[model samples]
Target: MNLALVFESGDYVLIGVFLVMVLMSVVTWSVVILRIIKLYQAKQGNTAAKQAVMESASLEEAAKKVQGMTAPIGTLTADAIAAYRNYRNTEAKTLAEALPLNEYLVSQIRSSMSRSMRQFDGGMTSLASIGATAPFIGLFGTVWGIYHALINISQSGQMSIAAVAGPIGEALVATAAGLFVAIPAVLAYNFLNRSNKTIKQDLDAFAHDLHVRLLNQKD
Candidate 1:
């Protein structure tokens, strides 16, 4: 009835389940690391681009200055500036005349921001699904183990600790493996969700700033 002996006698399928759980954990960690790096880079690039845009003399000047830069923030800024320039060139004098144009332009910028957000959020859904399902998968394995153990017990008519220990140990190991896979995956999913929210907030702020600048130009 020693734990070591129980494990040694446990089914190999249970060990395989534990190995799969470990692999899932590794994959989840890898995704988290990659996403963190990407989000950090995008945030830094966006801050720099926003600073450059604010410091520029005019929308056209800002566009020209940031033309070569490629980041979600930079692209949004460029689109806003271009829309404003196009509206001005058409020389629509009244606020009513320009409002529609401004709205259309902002819509374009918003759509671009949304697309970029989706790109940044890649692989997060899969991670979430894995987090939600891994424990259940492990549970399924445990149930299978337990069923087999009970069958062996019934057939052998030996209800002693030695007869029941190995299968029970294997079943419990599946539960442990399930937790090992699920915990970090759930944490990563939450972290990425928060990060996405922050990014969306930054995009919204940028859009509002652009709208304010356009209104000031009309004044």
Candidate 2:
């Protein structure tokens, strides 16, 4: 059937709800796609910063190169470098003197990483909510449609398929609309979750390496 005909044939209220579902689906997918792109870019930037830090001769040079990168890994590296520089400048005689400074820097890096993670995690909650509730919303439309269909049958005292088909078909459309909204949302939610995990892993690894490098510098 043509799109316009299907829509015109359906109960107006159900059609309205279906349109709303379509809007929600579009919004949810848009967020998923945008976030994925941002995360991918962040990942690529992190990789490049890691390589640069590993290859650089001195921590100061590495920090300078990475300072403007702004990705989580680069920011952590910069923080570590700053902490090491501060410790060296102070010319501490023992680990006791250096330990406090390093701890402070690690704290800063951790906070920054956490904030980045939260920012990346945006829109996931909305997607989850939509995935969970859309079916029920559709079911509500279906139930409404069925109720009206039965009311019509009672008033007309007829059992003909022609008399019943329109309302029943309209009701089923709600279920279909709900599934249409929900399926993509659920899929996107899962995919985005896995992507977030991967990003978190990379961030954790970078943080660990930076911690080790900072500790070694103190010795």
Candidate 3:
């Protein structure tokens, strides 16, 4: 008659819907928590690394300061320095090395940026997929629940409002559950996306400055 009773009397399909929603919710929160921690650490480390690079007198000094750093800036600076060293040290230059030093450094830094960005991109696709699909899955459950409710009413020959309302209301819970699962996923997706965009801007700026500094140091 009530929500509990509806669930208690529900068949496998209804229970399956509930289970699926629960799983989605668990996955969503797990990703949200892990990503928050990751981005926070990355942002903090990157800030420090950027400061170190900005304050340093030369690329070699910056490399020494940021050595073993896991953040994007560290990766970019390390890769740039390594490439520059290799370009200078190589006795026989390959065809790829035929490119101007600036162009070659730009290419290497871009690759490093991509690698760093990939670390932040983990779980984003899953969040997006859940945000897009959860509502529909819940709606399907609601429809199925209503079908079950109507079947029970027909068998009981119950046409009264109370009898109809209880099961129908119970069925509506599926839709509510769907929204409950989806809203958080969608919100998290947007929030994390914005956070990543900010980090990307920082990476782009750092890359340009790093390139320019490398060029200047070369000269």
2 against 3, candidate with superior TM-score: 3
lDDT (CA) per prediction? 0.78, 0.80, 0.88
Please list the residue runs of candidate 3 whose C-alpha ends up more than 4 Å from where it truly belongs after superposition. Answer: 1-3
Model 2: per-residue Cα lDDT over 81-172, one tens digit each: 77666666776456544467657667766877887788777899989989998998889878877887788788999989988886687677
- The parts of candidate 1 lying over 4 Å away from their true place are 1-16, 88-99
Worst 10 residues of 1 by lDDT: 1-10
User: What global local distance difference test value does model 3 have?
Assistant: 0.88
User: Model 2: runs farther than 4 Å from truth?
Assistant: 1-12, 83-99
- Which candidate, 1 or 2, has the higher TM-score? 2
lDDT of 3 by residue, 149-193 (tens): 999999999989999988888888888888999999999999999
Task: Estimate candidate 3's RMSD in Å.
Answer: 1.5
Worst 10 residues of 2 by lDDT: 1-10
Order of candidates by lDDT, top first?
3, 2, 1
> Clashes in model 1: which pairs?
none
Model 1: per-residue Cα lDDT over 1-219, one tens digit each: 253543565577665666677788888988999999988888888898889988998867888877977767888887777776667677646553356766766676777788778878787987988799889878977887798789889998999987787677757777777888888899988998899899889988987888778767742
Q: How good is model 2 by TM-score?
A: 0.85
What's the lDDT for candidate 1?
Answer: 0.78
